[model samples]
Structure formats: structure tokens, C-alpha cells
Target: MTALPQYERLEAPAIWREGPLAQRREVIVVFGDATLMIADGRSARALTHWSLPAMVRRNPGKRPAIYAPSEEEGEEVEIDDPVMIGAIEKVHAVLEARRPHPGRLRGWLGGGAAAAALALAVFWLPGALIAQAARVAPEAKRVEIGQQVLGELTKLTGQPCASRAGTRALTALAERIAGPSAIAVLPEGLKGARLLPGKLVVIGRETVEGPDTPEVAAGEIIAASLGAAQEDPLLRLLRYEGARAAFWLLTTGDLPETALAGYGEEVLANPAPPPADEPLLAAFAAAGVSSTPYAFARDPSGESVLGLIEADPFKGQPAPRPVLEDAQWVALQGICSD
Candidate 1:
């Protein structure tokens, strides 16, 4: 196989324009990588990315190279630093002289043929891989993983909710937003809501009970589900785990028992996923919910929500469904407390 560049520990000197109003002054140069990033500190936040070989060819070894913008021109600075310029020149020479391995050339050809075959299979079989994945990912395994995660979450929270009431309320809200056909399943570490292979909607309680109202919770659930509709949930899982994981899932029908434990803690600590316009709009219209609260909750500045606000799906009309009844609302909030 042709050896790709080893990028493990190499660090390159980055350049930046020092003074205010300097043009194309800042440059961030990484020595050994597929691509290079260049930032101009002179102008207001000017950044550019270029292929490594392309950048090397453009700057040749003579002096410090300044990349001037097409629209405006700026005076170039002379870089006489022997050490810094020498390093860059050496890397450029090495890149030019390096040749692809013969074995790697054959492997690349084989990989291309394999990729073409895989594409043909996917096109003709449509979801054959995903279906295969689901069978190997048994419902029993999912339920087991879900229960384990629930156990950890309860421990983290110091106790289970006063009752299953919080879960019931969440489920109710999910039903309202997803319509009666949707099912809400709670699992431990799914940082955000997930649409499972069996048309199941998986969510984490933190997102539901986090600052947003039931409407916001419902919006996220529907958004996740819509994304799943476009692609299989199992495929997403495979993507996260890689082709080996996909193969394992297909062969065994279940992800490893400890598969999601580590991620659970991270999900609890991070910011929740935002409800984007397309899915949010679709879910909002379907559930008769307003996008206002969800949008603001995601972006307090109101700038990120321009899309939602401008194309308000619930424009000038009453929202279709109440996310949760009064009793359910109280129950959901008191979930951990109880």
C-alpha cells in the first residue's frame, strides 16, 4: 500500500501580520499534512486554506511569501529568517521528490474497484446493509443498553425520578410532536435525540428537562427523527463506529455492551444540539408547535434563528398541539426531584 504522509508529531511555524491594518500579514503554516491553513492577521479575520503541494510550489524557497488578496493589494514583507524559511523549503523539496509506492498504486486501483462494486450494490440493494445491521443489532441488546444507561443516569442524578412520570411526560410530548405513530425511547448517553432503526426516537433526559419547554423538547425529537428518515439510524451508528463496527454490527446483531458508556457522560456535560430550520420547521408544522422558544433557547442572540423566525411555520395561526398537558408539564420538571 502507498504510505500516506506521517502527520503524528510534526509542527510547522505559523506566521501572522503584527500590526493593525496590515494586509495578508498572518500565516499559519503546518509542515507535513494533506492541506495547509493560512490566516492573514493584517486584515479583519482573513483566513485561507490551500493544498500542501500547491502552497509549496507557490512560495518557492527564496523569501517569506506573502499571499495578497485579489481585490486589494498590500506591500510584501521580506522574511530573512534562515531557520524558519529553511524548514519550509526542505519540506517542499521532500514533498516534490517523494514517490508513490508500487504496492500502494496497485492497492489504490483495487480500492477503486471495490468502491465501485460497493456503490453498485448499494444502488441496487437499497438498504440491504442497513437492514442487515438492524438484525444483528437486536432489540434485546438495545433495550439492555437503554436500561444500563438509565441506571447510570439515575445514579448520576442521585435518584430515579419521583416516578416514571417525567418519562411519561416526555413520551407524551414526543407523541404530540411525532404524531401517535412515533415512539420515544430513552437511552443513557445519546448526546442528542436519535432516530433508531425501528422508527423509535431515542432521547436523553437532560435535553428534555434542560431550560427549554416541552415545545423545544418536541422540536428536537422531531428534528432528529426527520434526519433519521433521510438515512438509517443504524447507518449513522456504523458511520460513527467505522466499517469494522458496521461489519461487527451486521455479524453479531448487537453493539458491544459497553459501547456507549463513555459518551454518556460527555453528552450530559455538553451543549445540546440545535434544532435547524428544515427539520424544525417540518416537526413544528406536524406538531402544531411554535419555533420561537426553541430558536431563542438555542441562540439567545437571535442571530442564529433568522431562518426559523423569518419562515415561522406556525405563522398567524394557533399551534396545532399542546406539547404537554398541565399535569405532564409539572411531572416532566419534577422528574429528577421526585
Candidate 2:
């Protein structure tokens, strides 16, 4: 975010609705560290802070410009103050300029015929080309592809639950298991943790709400992330769909719907096997979580998953650190409640 020297410490009067049915209250708003700070006007005490980039105007080209933290968040702010509104608009414009243009910035997504011509010039076998494409894709393009796949999966697995507090807890848990990887918990249809391209890990509600503690759930994330390390999720999809799918995606920046038809169902039915015991244990150890709970979760009798139980890294010892706090665990279990 670019600093607006002129708008530094800009303050304005506004009315805030904390929720959809909450009564509107007089408030004082100011700019603070790329966030919009709301305060109780009577006591001048802090109420909440909204991220600048996440702010969206509910009503545009209107006298009282209504802004909310996001389209889904129900809270609202009525800002009729012209100067403050202008300041916000200016900040958004500046941030927009800095944002990358999708499909145009980098990677295999290219300009029409030019990409097609390049694709033909590469004489590598179909399998080889698909492998090459997956390996070379940039982070932005990978994320875009993963998001599109997620959209397709949603047809089978509703929208991923994202209550504010629940999402925060899930984020912390995912980061602990795998550096910066995101875990999206779906309400239904997913059988287990599915690692997607762009470091996205998808899980079913059972992982969160079924386990008494987060250790088992964290183990699921760890196993999926470990599997993804050996076989890149993007490459796995490309392999399943074959050359045509890879070629089209590289040239047009999309996965063919026909290729993805019933793909979600296929994934749900055939969950990836847990990673090799060596790596799985290493990952569990690195995360400071026990492997035994996950072992039992996989096989209650400890017959099929005896190795994970007996070879547990933290065997007979307490976890080096807790998987989650009592409050964080409670919130995560309710992630899909809303």
C-alpha cells in the first residue's frame, strides 16, 4: 500500500452497523496502517479495524457511500463525508495499479496464436511437455489454476466454510504443518485431505469436527502436503487428463470442463494413500505433533496403520507444543456452522 501523506491520520464521522440487524451507532473513523480504524465516538475507544484492500463500497455514485470489509461480511459503514470517501477511493486506485494482471503477467498463459505456435515448436512427448508445464508454472498461474479447480470441486462439495475466527484458527494450524500452505475445509463430498496445486490443501468437515483434538487433523494436512512434495498436484491432474488437457491449459489458461467432468467425484472416491512412513513421521515430527492419534484415526484397531502407531515420533512423550489452544479448537470445529 502506498502511503498518502496528505491523508495521514485523516479522521471523519460515520455511522456503523456492527451486524445486519444491529442498531446503527455514531462512530469516529481514521486511517491507520493500511486499515480503516473504527472507534466508539462517545468514548473514543477502538471498536474494530478493517483491512483497506478488503474494503468494498456497497453503494457507488451515491450521496452516502456505504462500505463494508467484504462482500460477505455483514457489517457496514455509512460514509457521507466527501473528503474521507475521496481519500479511500484514491488509496484503492493506487493499490489497484500495483496489483498484477491475471493471465497476462506470466507463465504458460499467453496471447492467443503466439502461445499455440510456441507449443507446436516444442517437440517433446506429450507426457514430457505436461511435466515441463507443471514444473515451470509460476505461483500466480498455479494459484489461478487451483482456484478454478476449486470452483469445479464446489459443485460437488459446496462452498468451503469461512467463518472469520474459524478461518484464522485453520490458517494457524495449516501453517504449523506446512509452511504457508492453505487448508480449505469443505462441508461435504471430500473424503480426506486433498492437496491441490498452489499449496492448497482441501479437507472434509470430519477432520475438524470429528477429532477431539487438532493433532489428528493437523496430521491429515501434514500427510497430504507430504504426498504433494513427491508428486506435484498440478502434474497429477495433467497426468490424469493427458496431453490435450495440458496443451490447452498451457495455451489458453484453462482446464477443459470435459476433462474435469466427474473429476471431483473421482477424487472423493480415491483418496491418495498416506505418504511413506519415513516422510510422514518426519513431517509429523517437524510439526511437533504426534503420529499416533492420526494412526488411530486411520485405523481404530491399529491393524492397518500399526507402523504409524508403534513408530510414533513423540511416543510416550507429550507434544513439544500444543496443536491448538482450547478456544482455537472450538472455533475450528464450528468453521462450517455458518
Candidate 3:
């Protein structure tokens, strides 16, 4: 979902509790298109992003409204500001209204339990079952899981860098270089690029802020996309969580927080190796982006990445098109400024 225009600039103070036993700390809340962004009040480092649709209000018509991320009970946030509470309620109302009402479609879906059971019965060996789970997971569920993992990453990375104009530029850059994928630039934590589920890639702010030309950032994103193309990130998550996690997802349609715990740390600890040279060069050649910047970024002395530098596509000529427009690049540079 995209950022909601009406509440793009709206932010307020609220009490955030990470879990049932965690201490309640004051946090700054911002409304995104379909999520509630909670950030540290002092540092402004993002703490967690809550899905509004999955959220449930614990206190209705109460002065200080409390909300939780799931029906089974999980992290909670309390808001006293009337405007913030109203904005949150408004989005929740719309999402609830948009639910498929009890009709022919809903009835048909409800009656399809046999098909679901059939699917679950098609499992294989432990390794194959995990692969099958990831293979059949729907896009929406994949995106939801991706966002959850991203929030977990906040514990170590701090908030992702974003500004209205800067985010717009980021979206354009992602579409330009990586098809319909989403890319995030974090203020800190990541040193390079890390692929997340749901076609999301999180890169260090340096890739965007340190480069004079967008070509460098373009190269980083291109390389990350190449890694994702080679391996399904969802499979990585399932394999990390073990076979039981995949089985739960196949039977219950969602993984519990317990099942997903520590996944962010796992990803940060073990990043995927760069894609092979042949495919990397081919991708660079096809996108009309130069591979020299990427090679240089990896090894400034040009010792290790000599192959990329030597076989660099478009070495003698300019790219087919600029990676990003001048204005877009300028905005991207200041993404973390706010």
C-alpha cells in the first residue's frame, strides 16, 4: 500500500509496549498508508511498524485508546491524543469496510476448506515441504511477512530513512532498476544491500547518500536484485525457522511471532553472497547501467573486482539513460535528513 496523503505529515506522541512483559515507552507515531509507524521519541529511530488492518482496538470510546497488532494478543500501543486516535480509527474503519462481505464470493471461499486441506495433504519430505510452502505462499501474505521481518530489523538498524520527496524518488528508482520491487535505505545498521521477502531490498544509507551519481546506487540495487533472482528469500526464512515453521504456515495460513522470532538477526548475521559475474554483467548490460561503479564500490583498489572492471558493460560509452533524474537524485541524497 502507498502512503496516505491526508496523514502524511501527521505525527503524535503515544505509549508503546513491545510485548506483554516489555516496559511501556513513549514513542512518536506516524500513519502510513496501511501501517502505524512507531519511532523512538528522542532518537526518531523506527521501533516497529504495525499493520492497521490486523490491529484491534482494546478500548472503544475510551480517553486513552489501546491497540494490539493481533487478535491473539501481542505488542500494544496507547494513544491519548484525540487526532491521532481518530486518524488510526479512520483507517481501521475503512479497512474493515473493505472486507469482503458475506456474499457469493465469501461463501465460495468459506466452502473451499476441502481444497485447502487437500493442499496441506500434498506435503513431502521436510526439505521439500519447506520449499512447497514458500512456492505457494500468496503475494499478500509474503508482503505481510516481509514487513514483520523489517520491523524486527529495526531493533538493530534504526529507522529507515525517508522524506516525502525522497521516498517518491526511491519508488521511481526501484521501478526503474528493479521492476516492481520495493527498496529501503536505512539510516544505519546495514553496510551494503540485503534482500527481504516480498521483493524488498534494504540498503545502507551510504549507498544513496555517499554517491555523487545515481549509477553507484543503481549498481548496488542491481546487484542485490540479482541475488534475489537467484534465491527465493522466503525460502531462506523458512529454512532458517526450521521445518515446523513451514508446516505451521502451510496448515494455519500464518506463522506465529514465536516462529518468526530472531529472523531479522539471522538475516543481518548472514548476508547472501554476490551473484556470479556472468549474470551480474548481463544484468548490467541489459539495464544499460555501468558495472564499473559497482566494482569500484566493492573494491576501490580494483584488486578483487578486476573481472567486473575488465568485463564492465558499457565501459566506453554512457548509459542508455540516466539512472535517475537530477531532481530525484538530489532528493534521494537527503532521504535521511529529516
| Model 2 TM-score, 2 decimals | 0.62
- The per-prediction tally of clashing pairs is 12, 0, 0
> Taking the tens digit of each residue's C-alpha lDDT, what string does model 1 give over 1-338?
11124312122335544333674344434323444444443432435444444442225544555432222333223334342344334444444335354666767766655664454333212234444554467656655544544454544444433458777886677567654234343433444465544555555556556754676666666676667556655555444443333444555655555554554353345423544577768677766888777676657788978888767787676576677887898787666566
Error of 2 at 59 (Å): 57
Candidate 3 whole-model C-alpha lDDT, 0 to 1:
0.79
**Is candidate 1 or 2 superior in TM-score?**
2
* Model 3 stretches astray by more than 4 angstroms: 1-124
Instruction: Assess candidate 1 and give its TM-score to the true structure.
Output: 0.49
lDDT of 2 at 309: 90
Clashing pairs in 3: none
lDDT per residue, candidate 2, 234-334, as tens digits? 88878777555675677677766676776677667777777888888888888899999999998899998888999999999999888888999999999
**Better candidate number, 1 or 3, judged by lDDT:** 3
Clashing residue pairs for model 2: none
**Model 1 / residue 135 / CA error / Å:** 9.0
Report the C-alpha displacement of residue 292, candidate 1, in angstroms. 1.3
* Residue 232 C-alpha lDDT in model 3: 86
Runs of candidate 2 exceeding 4 Å displacement: 1-124, 252-259
Cα lDDT tens digits for candidate 3, 1-338: 32434312346789999888999998998766667889999999999888867888898988789988888776888888664675566555445444566754765655464444333234423466678889999988888888888888887889888899999999989878864378888888787788788888888888888877888888887887788677888998987775556767887889866877788788888888988889999999988899998899899999989889899888888888988899999999999996
- Better structure of 1 and 3 per TM-score: 3
Candidate whose TM-score is highest:
3
Go through the candidates in order and give the C-alpha RMSD of each one to the true structure. Answer: 14.6, 21.1, 15.8
